[model samples]
Target: MKPLLFMILLILFLPWTLRAGDATLVSGTVKSITGHPFPKADVHICDSEDGRPDVSAQVDGKGNFTISTAFRGRAYIVITAPHHRPVGHAIFLYGQPTLAVDAVLETYLSGTHVDSIQIIGDFNRFEFDNGILMTPDQNGLYSASIPSPKKRTRYQIVIYESKGAGPRSDEVRSINGIQYDELEYDSAGDYRSVINTTAPTTTVSFDVSKLPIAQGTGYLKLMDARERDLVATMMSIEKTIYNFQNAFIAAGTGYEEHAKLHDSLNTLLDADVEAYAKQTDDFQRELMTLRMLSYVELSGSLDQQQVGKAIGFATSIPPSSIAWSAYPTALGTLLKASGGNADTRAYLERVATQNMAVDVRPAALYFLVGHAADHHDTLRQVTFFRQLVENHPYNHFTTSARLSYVPRTEIVVGKSLPAFTFPDFEQPKQSITGSSLKGKFVLIDLWATWCGPCVEERDSLLKLYRQFEGPQFQIVSISLDSDPQAVRNFRKNGPEMPWQHVHLPGVWKSPPAELFEVATLPKIIVVNPEGKIIGVTNGLKGAGVDRIVARAMGQ
Candidate 1:
């Protein structure tokens, strides 16, 4: 099962999903790209990304599935079928019950006999089309064109071969930021073989002379020897980069430990891994570039002059001057106004032009584009977006990047919200719709009774509501709680503030959750009198929310 990554996104953006609304009904259908009816698929309705399903239903023999749900603010629907990857979309159901969404399901493969395998990471998520099979060349060498993402992303690849067995055992070997466990087969039964790479907390320069290659291995061992040390160093560097990134985003204690690990990795750049650096694979060169980038970031936590010294050291080594896939973006963010822009651009462009994989090019462009956009170069931004669309129109992320530059008014925002009608908990006779607030400043708050932060923010929300509760403003609270009883009890016992409240029988896929990208709870959206969004507050303090409400009300 995929890690509950959605849960994390929900927590991060909760302030936008929890909102209360009037009674309304929302209905939708599911279909394929080819207009074929989809059946027996599970449908979900939730308030935010973390919204739980209030109502779940399946299509009949025909491809149509419609269920009633409330539209407090924004909602989303996720659909899944056996042997098919789940797909979801966002919809705004202010109160219109007749909303329709036709979804397409992507096919997923199962079972063994797997051919070429591809991976997705910081560069991109893995897709079926991206995989390539390993083929043995005439020279008795197995080779495959495994591309890496343009971003300084890390990934690991594992190869499983079934041979001589009651079942196919794995001959797992990890590479390119990928990880795997070695599978050994003998009469005794399947067991792990050697632990080839030790987990290093910090990226360390491997001393090639100290490494030993045993004399009694097979042909695979011989080929591995040609690249093993370099591969090991690259993997270690990649791990270090991940550690730094995690530390950068993680909250609370042990931060110093992470910082020390970052510094320790930088120390390896000067330790002389020249033997691996001279290898034919691009692995070592890439590792050096990554090390230099990390060194640059590490310098910032120290003295300011230390950064200059680190850059001077980076400039001394030709390969170290470049940025690895994801490093350019990090470095750009870190060194924006510093004079490192020129060097960073040069390094990024060089990587774009290298024998690097197909996905690697766009990341360089994105970093450069980000820098240019930061400087308000609309032409450059347009050009980059256009390039992305033209070159990678079919790529999943291309459209998202294209949409980023577009003002909300021009695309999915400003338009009248969708209509929704669902039953109230008491009588099952509640209906909600966006049209009810045709000319009011609708304060949409997406929350769940279970979310501690959300519960804490409710008081401030109530205060804000009371302050703005005249003809010009209204508050809509949409609960993402999966249980209906919880929503009713919480509203009754938690806070005495008077406001519109609606609970979608569906949990996370509620029509409102999808509309607003309510990945997090406790989200607050300020809708103008024209039903257009004025601003969105992800985690604003109650005081901050009050200020926004006052400004919206012209107080």
Candidate 2:
């Protein structure tokens, strides 16, 4: 289930309209499928199927709601109580005497077929416990009911049995009639419990460890909780897709089974996520998959026609959707590949104009800046930046306005490298300008000490640098470290590589940082001898970076 905080934040921007008429009195109580009354549940009435609000209320302590408002047409009513599954039903709102309806919520459970399973998942928004307990019925079936709870939820069931009877309170639990280490429920743990959507059986597996555990002995500890149902199963699979997508892009190989599962899970996830459209996690996963698919073409592994098809698929995504952080990242890649074509630019422009709940405007602005810079369209960048700065004057992103849109005159790519100066490691002033290296290919690696991915790729950069080292090929490294001591430490203790290196002082506010739109670390930019920009790539680690360097250097 989406976090309440996240959902509230998303709803902050929902459009609302006021309507008046002869009032119709509607009252109802929210109940779970198991016949439990829901308390403090939100009740909403919308005039349209798209959920345009007409009137809303919250269930009282007695799980009852009363909405007296004027209406002319039919409206849809929705019930969402905390910690329970959400319920939706239609209401006929007219100048009538009264309207009454009963809303029922489904019982939330992690999975089926566990002797004693601990529940964990997104339902409690990853909280270890939301107090959703399952008890076996007379028919030998485990069941629990939650009243009209929040809209979306993802939950997991961990079954625990007793191996030996020492005391009622023991940490280690049993599985399959055997006892082993209790399931470690760490809030920060990397494992996300996945349930089998295809079957009633609750399947538990961790991403960090592929080992499958079942319910049995002592007391089972469950980790990872969300709203219970098929939604949780779909979220788990979406996460799997994202993981595999990243793995494939990094390794330049495909995982067929994972991909198939990803597609299969996406069908259910799409409907579930859209039904509860206020969350960004699902959007994040989808955008990531789209970006990964784009990489299959951007890496030159696929032809331009293939790239076009991918872009078409990307454009097919709904327009109102925003990906928070991933939105800009995806936009950047698409712009680079499609050169801001009509369809692609339309999407970019829409994102730029939309009211983003997250701080994704900066990324959108940066993509536009990059596009304007690449095309030398100063007017576009200037207009966009000015609008951004003016509209969001107090926004944190405004600080980078100057660097976001640089003067075209100062940025020359094809001629001898522009005259630019950066501070040396010893503060002795080291510089690289057009006059110094007029006829050599230079690869600039914009990195920082604090970035783990940057550090991991250091060896690959070194190897790529060494491979192309000659009169025509050179490598320059720039560090965006706030503390000079940190850069010095990295220089002394980090990967040992012989290359011209300099630190630009501030961490992210450095001049070059905003100028180059270095949102994340480890940015690689290829420049010809004359300083003509060739290619720019980021998030390249290990062999991924190696391949980029090799292809760039014609090796």
Candidate 3:
């Protein structure tokens, strides 16, 4: 009964299926050039690159094939036959019902067929030798195609000369200050070949003869005074980076050349950022900022004054703009530039706690608490930690915050060392507690691998270990890393913290972080044999570390 109803429905809608807006059906003919022997071609079809379903078929004796699949929207069709070049076509099947793609397989070559020809770009990870091979079929356009899930992608072409010829010894040529060298065909300053998949066109072309190759400086000169415009400056920067990348290929990728190019790129980036500031069109400014602001602001060369200007621009972002639609990473940049200080704290409090237009407080406060301990401001650290935990506990920023606040509020120099027990790093079952070493002068060091200050203080820790690692003087380094394996991994290659190493996961929210009232990492609590807290990280970091340890030992 179901089959009979389906047959009736097909009879009723057969005309519509053959016409427009029906299920996607691709029919094609794979014709081999006359007199060129080739096996039956394999027809490969896929909807998208990201693990989407794919369908395959084979060409019949007459070189005719049809593919019926559930794929809609963008579809990639590839045809490959033995001893012949492969061909791929990109098509949009959203509004179309049935499509016709004819592929002609050719075992022939055109113009001086070099050692190899390949397409390299974001699609192929830009690996020259391993790029997608382009084969000309019956002297058709030399091209390769991949279904782009992205709206568009940029690519360059590479051609290798025969091995006997070796590499070119001299610069091929220079046009408008752009040099295209490295003998083997390098698409250096070529107008970037971008395939915008937004169009429903089936085949994307890369005809080198028609490309505007090596015309960057020439394009800028034509722009003339308009080069000062933000978009124009960004274009200029893009061309400059492209030229630099080609130079890397020409010069053999070296760190020295990379550093020099980075300096040059940074200059152009500064200009682009300056242009962003002066952009008069609000929408264009937002667009430009969205594109290049993150690059410029995080370049680490932006002066405090420049950061001030950027902060103002970020604040001015209209709520409706897509730039403001997502969490403002621009705010995070400003907060990092300011670092943890009175001004940064005030900003977070006003912006987030006060419910200002752009709420940066929740994120900013978490970072402040982490950095506050670096400067040895326990008061400021605790104050903001409490505020973040109490106020924005469920905000995405605070969700990973400390699980619970430490009960012991203050960690003074004269107070009794806070009691605690943690498993040894290597022997997890063996407990290392405050009571384990009753007669020795102990140093309870709280730290994690992710802490920059703790990493810097490693040499100091090693020096103290060497100078006074004895029975009378003991140091137990406790880690607050969330991953126990991370501590083991760090110790594997990093400076070995061999003396009584202990692991206590959850750096910011652990019992150890709370017991010592850790403001920041590399926090060392010095205690006498009597278990009285003698000193903190303050005297145990610089030149004072050895002095305090020797004093603790009473030597």
Once fitted onto the true fold, the runs of candidate 1 whose alpha carbons sit more than 4 angstroms away are 1-289, 292-304, 307-343, 346-350, 353-356, 392-400, 406-531, 536-555
Best of the two (1, 3) by TM-score: 3
**2 against 3, candidate with superior lDDT:** 3
TM-score of 1: 0.35
The candidate scoring highest on lDDT is 3
Local accuracy of candidate 1 as per-residue lDDT tens digits, 1-555: 122434432332121222233444444455443334443356766543334555567666666666765433334456654323455543434444355555555433222333333332222343223444445445433343333323222333333333345222223322222122332211111111222343322121111122111212111111223233433443455566555444433322334654575556445544434433464655454445455555454333443454454454333333222223223333443334245367756665554444132233455555555556556888877776676566545432353354344444421444555455544444556555667776888887888876545655655676676766788788878888878777776655555547777777556578666666554457787778777777675545577778877887787
Error of 1 at 140 (Å): 41
TM-score of 2: 0.38
RMSD of 3: 19.4
Q: Candidate 2 at residue 66, lDDT?
A: 89
Candidate 2: where are CA atoms >4 Å away? Answer: 1-307, 322-326, 355-362, 394-401, 408-444, 448-474, 481-506, 509-555
Query: How would you encode candidate 2's per-residue C-alpha lDDT over 1-555 as one tens digit per residue?
Result: 323322332231222222355677878666554444553456666543234345677688776778887753323455554323344533333355566666655433222323454445544554534535566556554544333233322354444444444223222121111111222211111122223243333323222111223222211111112112112333343455455434433432223533553454444334433443443555444444454443432243334554565566556555434332322345666766776876777777776666242244454666676677557888987877776676555444454455444443433334334456665555466665545655776777888765545654665677777777778877778888677776676666556557777666566778676555665567776676566766565555667666656666677
TM-score of each model, in listed order? 0.35, 0.38, 0.38
Q: Write the per-residue lDDT of candidate 3 for residues 1-555, one digit (tens) a residue.
A: 012222322221111011123455667777665433344456766432221125677778778888775433333456655323345543334323466666665432222435545666556655444667766655445666644556665555555434355535221111110111111211121122455565422243433333222211100011112212433434443454345434433333244654564565466546657898677877567545543445443244344465555555655554333222123334455555555446655664555443321223455566666566557678977988888777655544454346223334457788887677888778888988888877888877787765544654665677787788778788888888778876776676566567888876566667877677765556787889898888776313557667777787776
State each model's CA lDDT, in order. 0.48, 0.50, 0.52
